[model samples]
Target chain A: MSDPAPQVPPQLAAYRATIDNLDAALIHLLAERFRCTRQVGRLKADLHLPPSDPAREEQQVARLRALAEEAGLDPVFAEKFFTFIVAEVIRHHEAIRDELSE
Target chain B: MSDPAPQVPPQLAAYRATIDNLDAALIHLLAERFRCTRQVGRLKADLHLPPSDPAREEQQVARLRALAEEAGLDPVFAEKFFTFIVAEVIRHHEAIRDELSE
Candidate 1:
């Protein structure tokens, strides 16, 4: 990666360094989240559980949207992000279920 | 939201429920993440810090990609995810810096 411009304002560069640091934290958090969910997936597979719960998903989306608005973030964007994460989770659970059934 | 099929395999339905629950947990975790990051942005604004750090960004990308691979996820996808999150964080930081400057 190219170095941040040497002559650019130091403050701007510092801000970016902090942002990058936080982004790394986020990735680690996400990995931890997926690991926990993977365990849940395995449990469900053992019990022969379905891979999606429409009602619960709806409730969560509504709840998170409200929280997002309260936080001054765009509710719609938060909803979209949640949806994407949930979809990925469902996909993983489905794979686990298939593996267990076979 | 439509109910999961009544006649569908109970196991599949159970799996979906678990997945939904896990997804909800993930949303809460992400919300918490953003909250902490927002505080960092505010601090940067107060100090007049820059909003992008190329070297640090590169380091974080490499770190996250490795973590993703170790977690059985795609490194490339993790990189993209980090890139997206960093961009968003930078945007927020820039806005905060502008507000303070003005």
Candidate 2:
């Protein structure tokens, strides 16, 4: 059982249209980010380097926290979000390393 | 005790620069998204509409999942990311509604 949607006012619709476009843009940006990270993973594997770089990750966290504060967003949330993405990237990097070893 | 930073090869340095730019862009986009959502919260409060809309969220989940697949990203990860942002937006909306009621 689902309730029917209420009549969306025009202003709300316009805002949503903009939001949708921004969401699409965000996804594309993320895709590009992962693409770059994947290349890094391959390079690291070829070089016999570790999959994760803690120093670089720490630097990124600090840089992004500052950027988040500048953008009027919560630094903690930004850090959490970045951590989430980094975890995924590391997983991919580890997988790449394992594939190279096999 | 921390590992020393590696001498980054030029190719890796280039990739990191691109990743940093994309991360900054992502943060700005999210800031804009939250800005728009906050306005939506205020308007919903004015209209006495509910803070959370499950039906719309479900629709959005489906839409973004499809978009993620099209972008060659993991749909599950995309859904999880969207769900994370939506949770924050709902919390903001609830706060707005409470403020209006007071």
Q: Provide DockQ values for all models, in the order shown.
A: 0.22, 0.73
Off by over 4 Å in 1: A1-6, B1-60, B67-74, B86-102
Q: What stretches of model 2 exceed 4 Å from their correct place?
A: A1-5, B1-5
What's the TM-score of every candidate structure?
Answer: 0.62, 0.91
Chain B alone: TM-score in each candidate? Answer: 0.81, 0.91
- Model 2 chain B is weakest, by summed lDDT over 10 consecutive residues, at B1-10
The residue-by-residue lDDT of candidate 2 on A34-60, one tens digit each, is: 989999999999988888888889999
**Chain A TM-scores in order:** 0.86, 0.92
Q: For model 1, what is the error of residue A49's alpha carbon versus the real structure, in angstroms, after optimal superposition?
A: 1.6
Interface RMSD of each: 4.7, 0.9
